[model samples]
Target chain A: MSLEERFNEIVREYSERVYWHVRRFVNCHEDADDLVQEVFLKIWRALPSFREESGLYTWVYRIATNEALNYLRREKLRSALHFGSVDEEMLRRIDNDPYFNGDAAERALSKAVVRLPEKQRQVFILRYYDEMPYEEMAKVLDTSVGALKASYHIAQEKVRAFLSKVD
Target chain B: MVRKNDISTPQGYFDELKGRLGDIPHRDRRGVRIFAPWMAIAASMLLAVLIGNFILRKTAAPVEEDNGWDYISYLAQSLDPDGLPDEEFLTDVEQ
Candidate 1:
């Protein structure tokens, strides 16, 4: 297939998946939408030199995940500078999120997920929300499966405890 | 089972999204285009001005003003040493 066709196919295949991935981190529909576009824009730009060293799906996830992580860090720094707690700020965004259609329990679960440390958040979200296998996640995260499992286990415990109390 | 996602987009967002992404030209991936001819012209003009300034400095004599060192030397040469006040006499008058 021509390059444009290939790029379009990628967008068609991964956009929703990438969108939800970003949405989990950002907690705001608008921010997630913007970030999803940014992730694809980055992939499109870097498409030429994509050496195919990893699977295309893994590569796309890596780009989307990195965008989400970077966006989170920027938001955290901004929130901290503005005299707000990052967790509170993110939860506020989630509270105001128009696209979220979850029940109270799901909302509580999402809050619990957001409260995890950044790397653990990634591990938890990918494993629990996307149902991504650790082997595939390792390719996207550039982490060993063992480390991912440990992080997810810790994250899972934290979420479970938070849910038990809240839900 | 992983819970169903809470987030939802407007219907057919993915369809419109692909089209929007396609509109973005691949040139964006490449660095911005620098105007090479304009840069070359600017470099040449700068070089020309520098060379012209250097040549002017080398070829043109510096303009002398009143009370300049050359003028003072000329004035001292024109004077008779005998007609000038002695250093000892001048020092004594100052005291």
Candidate 2:
């Protein structure tokens, strides 16, 4: 198959999955839409250089995760520059998002997830939302499985604490 | 822990997104990371030049308002320089 054909197949397979992955990270459909485009563009560019060191799914998801994390980092910096809180801004977006159909409990859960530190947030999302295996996540995140477990533990506790207060 | 997705997109969003994304290899064959910045810079420079030209033209003195040199420059540009008056004649005229 031609490289373009392979790329198209990859896009058809992963675009929606990656879109949801990034959408959950940003909690805003507009930003998620833009980021998904960027993610696919990156994938297309890097497709030629793929070394096959990791499974294709793992590799594709790693790119998506990294792009989402970088986006959040930029948002945090932007909020800091404007003297606003990134967590609050994200919570606001989630609350106001037209695409978000979550119930009150789900909304609260999402806000709690957003409040976690970046690494913890990513870990929680991958585990809770994505149901991704630790081994696969480790490859995607380049973190040890033990560390991911610990991070997820800490993240779960934080979420539970936040939910308790809300309830 | 319950795991369920609470987010939703408009109908046919993914199909549309996939169509847009599938063209990346053809549309952005050169890679966005490279071309986007350079395109932005080139665009900015072009805009700046255009704006600068516009402003300069707007603020510039009109060509009809000769500062006493246009006549001399015009004379110098004549193909038949021999027919034009010499430095002594111009100095006499200026005085």
Report fnat for all candidates as fractions from 0 to 1: 0.58, 0.77
What does candidate 1's lDDT look like per residue over A1-167, in tens digits? 87777788888888878877888888887788789878988988888888877789899999999999998889779988998888898888778877788888888888998889888999998998889999999998998999999999999998899988885
TM-score of each: 0.74, 0.74
Which 10 residues in a row give candidate 1 chain A its minimum summed lDDT? A1-10
Compute the lDDT of residue A35 as modeled in candidate 2.
Answer: 97
- Give the alpha carbon lDDT tens digit for every residue of A1-167 in model 2: 88888888898788878887888799988899999999998998898998867789899989999999999989999999999998899999988988778799999999999999989999999998888999999999998999999999999999999999999
Candidate 1 clash pair list:
none
DockQ of 1: 0.35
Against the true structure, what is every candidate's RMSD?
6.8, 9.6
Sliding window of 10 residues with minimal summed lDDT for model 2 chain A: A15-24
lDDT of 1 by residue, B1-95 (tens): 33456767778877877777665555453334446667799999999999999999999997765668876775675585664455523565597
Query: Docking quality tier of candidate 1?
Result: acceptable
- Cα lDDT of candidate 2 equals 0.87
